[model samples]
Target: MKQLIFSLSFCLLAMSSLFAQGIQFESGSWADVKAKAKAQNKPIFVDAYAVWCGPCKWMSANSFTDASVGELYNSGFISYKFDMEKGEGPAFAQQQSIRAYPTLLFFSPDGELLKKAEGARDAEGLISLAKPYLKANNNANQEQTTTDNNWESLNAKAWEYYETKSNRSDLSKALKWANTSIEMNRNWYNLDTKAHLLAKLDRNKEALELAVDAILAAQDAGELAEAEETMELLRKLRNN
Candidate 1:
């Protein structure tokens, strides 16, 4: 009987250690955690809990501490835990439309809500809930990178033709490349390139409109140099 009890205790200790490691939740304000997520370009995982909730405590002691949960959450997400009833938590919960204890919220890097759930999840369930959002965000980031690369190449091609400007045909080709790039991304650089190409094609009105758009996009992106350049181009277009 004594040996059996000792064996049971050892087994329990081993199991505890097996699942001891878990998600490393960030200790920061909601704004700070959101900023970190944006900086890392990773999705945010918010554990909205209350001290009085049984399931919240269960998850804090079990599911959140599981090794697999830690591995996935730590690697793929900017994790945070907030008490729904304390500090900034109440305001955040109100803003997020959190209505229940142990609310699981996933947000994009830009702070858009991606997914939400109420109640506690087991380790496997939590992992399952999070995997799709992470995968979707990763895919979106990859696609945007690829699209940006393609737009850069097209923009470069357009610039080469614009620099040459040997004939009307060359100008037309430059406009085509610029149009393609703008279609891929309406970023300030591409929009400015398109505006200049339109100006070369003697479409002054369209060029002015595109230049304005470029300025606005630049302002949104905080690209002061691009905005300045677009302003100069806008003046030139207006003069024409």
Candidate 2:
């Protein structure tokens, strides 16, 4: 009878530990996090959010519920959800330089900041962003090489040449820069930049093609505003 009782007790303890290990959003004092993180040797993921942001709500409702996200987060992180306008949450947000709602900050077990991301990211995007930071040796050199390039900078430079050059003289340089931006990050903004440059060079047909691609990609990513705007611009350009 003593042996059987010990086995049952051990099983219950194991089950309890497994349950505690699952992905859960905790709301509490930052002090509470310090001990838990030390005990688990896991990083903390802080969601700095505000009540008034629609995208923040959408991320909480849709992105946070994703199965893969839940699995990865459960196993890999200690998660906290903070309301940026209330409680100690606001103070923490300010300390972390969180100027935007729905900012996500990742910190190492020792409380060193690993990465910070702002804006609404879907499940896949969030997973992609989190994977690199969870590495065993999360060094700055490894991070610098993996970080996404600033496509906007390249696009802005290309646009400057397109606007100033006479007789379409620098169109080739504009096209090259725009293409490089797209290759670096194939997001709606970069695609639109490429389309605009093509249109300026009087390559209306090519512009229309790139615009359509951008519209479809944005729509598929659930960026309705960008998709609609790009589609409308493409229609108008094709008509003219």
Candidate 3:
């Protein structure tokens, strides 16, 4: 009986330590994050989340705890998870025009906004999302490379074409450009835009299919709110 009790105590301590070994919330002001990023010359990954947000909880449970995400983030970023309703972070959220919870904002060490993805991101998706930024930073120190530039410029042009196109016939070019963007970046936002353009072109069937794909992708990535929204949009498109 004494040995059994000792073993149980040891198990409990081991379990506690295991949990503690996972990602830890860094406590400090945004300035602290900035200072750390500057000192380390790393990007800052800010997870803007709220307590009441279901997707935020999912992200914490699934995506943020994923080992791949942990390795990538721990290596390249000064990651900070912010409670969007609890501190000065809330004010920053408003300034950043965050309309939803579980928004992931990536910033350069110099404090430039590199990307703002509004959704829950699973481990794989989070790692994928952060990769471009990390690559960009690393490439900055090397000889100039133009691999991503064409895709970046093409994506911008596609958005412009989308904004101006009003007819299905006019949308073909935009669709083509957006598809090219997806092939290059494979970002959720790019895919979402592609779906939007497809819907606008009266390709409701294809649009709904793409929307469903996007929904699943977002869900898998731990972007709960985005998944829900995309699902709702899919339903509405189908109904129409």
Candidate 4:
């Protein structure tokens, strides 16, 4: 049984090597990989995975070996794989708050975490993940320096966009982005935005209660203008 396990492991390794010319991975400690990334002036791409995870295994077997994925990753980044359940992986996993089987983390060479995504991704999906990070790296001439994670900022951006953009797709994106902010914090403004978005969708049952709640909360806080605006929203929601 041990021999069979060894043979299987060897085969997997050999197969991975055949795809090695694609997304070549670093062969050293995690810290070493980070140092190499810094030295090379490149970002870090880590595949935080568990051995027994089926999706992790599938990704290793399939997506990691895709030539296009390899070309993009190998050209621009230092890649590393770690089994989060074992050895030094556990310590890093805890620091990174990795609660899932397969978490992909992208980091700056200076070791700042830039982005993260959960679950399995196909080659195309994985490639997509690299795009924003790549853009941030390549487009120094662009306005935004980093991706926005704060819900308040996102909520406000959504509001500004929604107010100015008449495109149906843009409206949907604004509403969706506001929904993310609402999920992050249910402050009055967040709830109000969510209520408005939900009302736009004709999601009356969901929108009505939140709009009313925001109105009452504003009234309690002596925020008369806010309460009045919320009441106006409640009227619109009811009319919907």
Candidate 5:
């Protein structure tokens, strides 16, 4: 009974070790990793390490397996581990100019190198190094969201005036709002709105030009559905 219990305990221990949570490193080419990062809107964290490096092995066995490290890296980054002395790893290391044993590289979603660090770090040290970049990225995303919201609100207000068309004065006010919206973001919807406002105000030539721009912008954004109205407007403007 005692031997059986010990065997069971050993099996449990082995299972736990096998399933231990850590930085979930992806298996793929560098291009695949970058593509995934772009799709997920997450940064890339590359562990450029060598097989014979003591520090690199120590980090892999200790710090990377820490739960906190796993949570942060797995969530915020598309992590990859490359053996710098083997296979395509040598070429990649050369390209990235990695000369050290355990170089940490942080890249933006678009694959721009954002940060680089050399040497191995404990879990706390690694977390501390990564936190600021993630925080900054989060803050930037929030600011962009706010800007988009503000521009959308402005566009809606402008469109309201366009729909009402109570007077020439209202059209003029709508034009101002539309211009501001376009300045904030020269996207198809706002461009279309501005073009319509210009047409209402009898600025046919400017309106036609803006309509064309809107159509092209819509196409570029893969928002061709929104371009149909703009196309119709362009046809009318050409006839006039």
Candidate 6:
């Protein structure tokens, strides 16, 4: 009976180890990390934790090590682990308004803060928390054929998915978003984003027209950065 129980325990231990596929965190200075995320057009996932926190350790050992959680987060965002008490973590934590251990923060590529969830959770729980953000990520380009496409929802989704578009279809969706956004509000941001998306998708003729128009309008509106950036985009597109 004793031998049989020992054998069962060993098997269980091995099974547990097999299932624990730990997450891999990227290493770099905070600025470089953010820049890389922006360049890749991916959202940032920060696992804000402290070394002394038991829940933090538990998550690192269990939740974060789960294969399901690792797969979901790895594909969905550029993940980082920050020790809230160490290095640049303190100031960042303060800025992010983190007062507890194991705060999961998601940020858009444009440095806009999206969600901040506090406390530790299992793999399923964590993924559930991140689900909406993930949907928003892809749906930004999804064809909005339904009357349900309100301007606030559309614009919010566009901002969330802006740089994080995955493929050519997404790029096309971004064009749709840009056009729809112009219909809703022909303001500088919408126009500028539309022109930028056009240039990115190599839809040159319209891109050039819109880019020039945007540059002129932005300059007239005294938005120098938008004007200059759009001008540079126009130049780049023309050269390419």
Per-model root-mean-square deviation over C-alphas: 13.7, 17.7, 18.0, 14.2, 14.0, 12.1
List, residue by residue over 1-240, the lDDT tens digit for candidate 1. 999999999998875564467988999799999899879978899999999999999999999998989878888899999998989989999988889899999877767676789988999999999998778667656544554457888798777777786554445545656777888877988888888887876778989999998888888998867477679889987786
- List TM-scores for all candidates, in order: 0.57, 0.49, 0.51, 0.51, 0.55, 0.55
Q: What's model 6's overall lDDT?
A: 0.75
- Candidate order (lDDT): 5, 1, 4, 6, 3, 2
| Candidate that scores best on TM-score | 1
- Tell me the tens digit of each residue's lDDT in model 4 across 32-97: 998997688577899999989999999998999898898789877899998898878999999989
Q: In model 6, how large is the Cα lDDT of residue 1? A: 100
Candidate 2 residue-wise lDDT, 107-207, digit = tens: 76656566788899998988897787566323322433443457777777666766686433245445656787888878777787778777876778989
Residue 188 of model 3 has an lDDT of 58
lDDT of 6 at 57: 93
Local distance difference test, candidate 4: 0.77
Candidate 5 yields a Cα-based lDDT of: 0.83
What shift in Å separates residue 34 of candidate 1 from its native position after superposition?
A: 0.8
Q: Candidate 1: global Cα-lDDT?
A: 0.82
State each model's CA lDDT, in order: 0.82, 0.74, 0.74, 0.77, 0.83, 0.75
- Over 4 Å off, model 2: 1-22, 137-240
